[model samples]
Target: MVRPPHLFAALARGWLAVAVCVVSADLAFCQGADTDSSSGTVVKAENREVSARFTPMRGQWKPASFGGDGPVSIKKTESGDELIEMLAGDPITGILWEGDFPKENYEIRLEARRVEGFDFFAAVTFPVADEHCSFVLGGWGGGMVGISSIDGNDASSNETTQYKEFETNRWYKIRVRVDEMAVTCWLDDVEYAVVPRGEHELSIRIEMDPCLPLGIANFMTHSELRKIEMRKLNVESGSTDPAAVKVESKTEQAN
Candidate 1:
């Protein structure tokens, strides 16, 4: 009944992973948690609770009426996954998550795939306290990633601008974290952008006004979106807990 030291270490690692996934019935949610930022700052994504989920069961994701946008619909895939599909958008197409969401200390997670076009496929607009901004994915001729309008600069011209090659028809995991301090984005576990909130003015373009507090859009692109979930985070920093602040009271005052 003897075991090697390496075997014991392997078992310990396995148990640690299981402990992390115990937060949700869907193991993918925990396994796919986002962390870190482009600035090399560590971010803890565990111990959070799911706040909102945009799915067929929710019945609140509506096609954005951005004038000549595409046809959008919810359909069950061959794999039995429910997804939102946007097709044939002349210039822009989008869907709005028609529900209240946290303005700060929350995370947005989704899977997106470009079916056609060479523009951004999953541009997520979310609230940053009183204002709103967007995480543009596969934009600017299909390879730019950044937040829209930071201190009056578009994603293409902002400090958070980044580039990553994207393949059409391939699903990409995307996560965005909006905390009291900064807004960070991750693409497939790779840190994409991180912009401090206080140092910059966060906003969306006039074309993205309809998105408002929360929504996902495409720029002349046909795309499929699925498993869009919003999560409320608890941990903040080592010295101070983010939840210690009266978030509910703060929200009411802002409103």
Candidate 2:
């Protein structure tokens, strides 16, 4: 059998191209398997190991109490997404979850939108060990975002203070991760803030104490909350020291 020289060269080039593509795809898949695209955290689970579990605190939230002079209801959007709507009114208006929730080494995620009013649309207060902290979004006149009452300083004056433009009626994804080393937050899947656990005490303001452990409150802002979830992170055993826990505000501390 006789074959043309050019045809043999062309077939060799085609085989080389296919080899290159296979190697490139394998490298990309290996990289993606070890990292989370949304949060930029490394995945610890192997092929046979089970991934970290996510516990649903509220896919559809029911309020323990609805404060303020407005209204709260579970409504479906035009796009068929279910959400809890809080109408604007008093100083605080929203739902509160009084049930038991994880206090450490966990992450909380939710979708929130400011439908009306001029204040914050999401003020999520959760426990950090024995203490508590609040992640405020679209707060302080709808531009400020930060954690409240770090070392007796409010979110506006704290080190995690940031300003972001939040549009009305537009949904934004918010996530917060609390661990022994630091408290990190992401807004719309972008890294927003990181507050390290150092000498500074982590505690909620006195006003936020009523919604302690786990709660969501809005200040004079009509908002909608949906897809609320909490996931426990796999922490190294014996990593937390109970004696190192600091309680800053005795008046607001949960009993």
Candidate 3:
């Protein structure tokens, strides 16, 4: 039952080809790690060498036009958008901004800090409605990050996963991944929610708004923030995990 020498050589060559293909695919993923379509990955903006910045203001959209309800600044990049340096201890409701992302998934990254009086609030809003949108992921104080859809006509329904703690004055990183039929939020690399995509009309743009109230018990009454950033990654075809280059872990200490 011994195989012929030529047949064995052919089989060896085929095995070698398969090995080469596997190696090439791995390298491709490493190179295209920022993509999110095929995989669920969190890519770092700084790793991409994006050097963008903008200033902040109150009651109006920042020069970048990311909106909300508070005193804040905006920075937008080819990859995505950001808001930062939110004034703390103000009794205002905070702010909100919008970006229209059509029928595609996206990656959002931002930083937040809670100071003394009021708790800090950070959110990734999606499923944008006419006058409002749902809170796909958000955090208040040291509580778990909450997920719920909000609109002018519907009551909020919480998505199951939750991100806990998140202290004051310490900068924390937040990321959300939205794909065809699922949405997930992560705080410092820890996953909070991974739920089936909700039923809402797709809007082409996403708006970011931070609410700052000048009164007590408001979104930014006791919060301070900075270094707000965002980046975009084109997900690779037929991939199940996010494409990401291994940058230093932004969430390593949060756990």
Candidate 4:
């Protein structure tokens, strides 16, 4: 006896259903692959790499005291680079700036969103005689910008310029520019701080004995990083637009 065509059709349908379920599970796994930084205006991380433009600085490692471990989550995309979370002792990773840079003015821009936790930190540095000059933006229940200098001897000189409040687990756009005699930072197009460079000349150089890596650190107990970007500015052309600056000073204290 031969089976009816309708019975064969029903069997085929059952097999098709199973195939569909398998494909769906595979796609979900791919989407969940370790990646963050989606928006182009932010830090481009798609596949497994991060996109950053600098004077093309290098990396130098420094011992950190935070009692935790974090991973540098990166992804590759069709157009640019992307990053998910950079954690050293916290959730996000630490950016280490250790390189030899020519004394010239430059601009830096990037986007960052807080996913979890209450605080995050990122900075740029110029090392001098075991001491380095830097600008740091930190957020803990809020956000702040400051200037600091660390000597190779482990001594630090620091000051806070802007302390503004920000929502936890949210994305904030940021821009920092360093010119010949001044430095400025912005949070979501808002002007936060402007400091005169004074007599300190920015220097970034690495020697065969020890290489320095230009760095940015995301310091948070538990947080997610959406994007990160870096660009060298043209000081002579004055690429900054004062008219577009926005200042929000609603400081949120750490809980």
Candidate 5:
């Protein structure tokens, strides 16, 4: 049962070498998890930096252009930013962005503030490929965020539904990006919802069709919108580019 001193030393060294190897392997595995395998780059989803370009759409919007039973007004603020307001009264009152809108792979951003009322302040209807969808902000008594009519269900009944407190008279920056894989939304630069694009059918409700192509509406609420901009996203680079084409604004009377 007695081993030579040299044999004992050899066994100890062997165990030490195995321990070193195990520790090295674990460190390597942990490092790999923080990297993007395909790109061989460090992955940083927490605060990913984005580079993007934006091009301004021409023609100042006129109140007469955006027709609805409720009052719609477009005024230039003291700071020279265009402000689009919809007064609360009718069930639905909105103003369509009268310009050519991209079908998909783009991000739309704007600043919205609830001036009055208790319902949704900004319901943005946009295009998702051939179909259409709406980003309902401050809905269901003013604290819901989600996409409408995913798989024939309204935003309140869909998987992307989320609730966040929204204060009236305070501006919030809202952004929505639609790509081939998913539709992601951010409020004040914080992510709010990520709806995967797959078997689900994306469509706007019948009442929202009037504001389609691209539009902002209020549901029995008074809302103000400004700094409305849209940029085409470059999928591979994860950046955005200014749209090249510019179209004249058109007026469509509300039905």
Candidate 6:
């Protein structure tokens, strides 16, 4: 049986529409949430360009006041680098991401440097499943570094604690990985803290309650931040797996 010319034309148009829809679905995931049974991770995609920018605008990212916090501003350095400047507070100061982010199997990266004062300058509080914990760098008088409130102990006393001398006005790359098994941190690619999740209860102290879900704070220290990024970790690098990127439609069964 030979199909009519009009029928062939209609089928071709339908196929074109289906192809466009498939491509759109893959890109649309960058703004939505999905889960893969293979990894059992709830991955939330994001537009990295917009998500990583720190312009200090309300609603996207806001300055946090943890008790008499100093002023927060954005400054462009001589090298054309834009950085978020957080002045030291009396007790604590920081900023919070006023947006939705991934809860598990995620990584947060940023560049930070201590400008003055003598305490934590790059402390980050992040989510772990339903609870939260903070990675303290240059805390407890500018040397202690670790994850806080592990099994009810603060970073100053947790099993993940370490001490290192940090010079003023020196930038360091910070990478934190939160996965199903552990919460790990590295400063300038040096592994500093690693805490397995199965045994210890991850939590934050009472003073850090305002920075819940996602936030950064400094304890009597001023600092600058650049190139802050938060992204999900389930997606493999250079992966072309159709199962994850392509969305199939019911075209063959159509009548």
Q: Estimate each model's TM-score.
A: 0.72, 0.70, 0.47, 0.49, 0.71, 0.67
lDDT of 2 by residue, 129-248 (tens): 788889899888899988887888888887678898999999999888777766767788665666656656888877776676788888888898887777776544333321112221
Cα-lDDT of candidate 5: 0.67
Clashes per candidate, residues 3 or more apart or on different chains: 0, 0, 63, 52, 0, 0
Best by lDDT: 1
> Which stretches in model 5 have alpha-carbon errors above 4 Å?
1-51, 57-68, 237-255
What candidate 6 gets wrong by more than 4 Å, as runs, is: 1-59, 76-82, 235-255
Best TM-score among the predictions, by candidate number: 1
- TM-score of candidate 1 versus the correct structure, residues matched by position: 0.72
Tens digits of per-residue lDDT for model 3, 72-134: 544554544433444542333344433323334445555565665434354444432132233
Which candidate would rank higher by lDDT, 2 or 6? Answer: 6
* C-alpha lDDT of residue 9 in model 2: 13
lDDT of 2 at 176: 82
Write candidate 6's Cα lDDT for 1-255 as tens digits: 101111001124434321111122123222123433332322322212222223222235678868799888866668665578899888888888888788876778788999999999988899988989898889988999888888899988866777889999999888777766567677886556666556678889888987888988888888988777765655333332211221112342252
Span of 10 residues, lowest total lDDT, candidate 5: 1-10
Q: What digit string (tens of lDDT, one per residue) describes model 5 on residues 140-201?
A: 98898888978898889877777878898999998887776567677887666666566678
State the lDDT of candidate 4 residue by residue for 1-255, as single tens digits: 101111001123434321111022122211221212221111112112322244312133343322444655545445444444555453445544334443444455555655555554455454333334455555443465555531221112233345656665566676665554355555676555454444343332221012133455555534443344444433323322211112111232122
Candidate 3 overall lDDT versus native: 0.38
Ranking by lDDT: 1, 6, 5, 2, 4, 3
**Candidate 6 TM-score to native:** 0.67
Residue 104 in model 6: shift from native, Å? Answer: 0.6
Candidate 5 residue-wise lDDT at 99: 74
The number of residue pairs in model 1 that clash at the backbone is: 0
Better of 3 and 6 by TM-score: 6
Give the Å error, residue 80, model 4.
Answer: 3.1
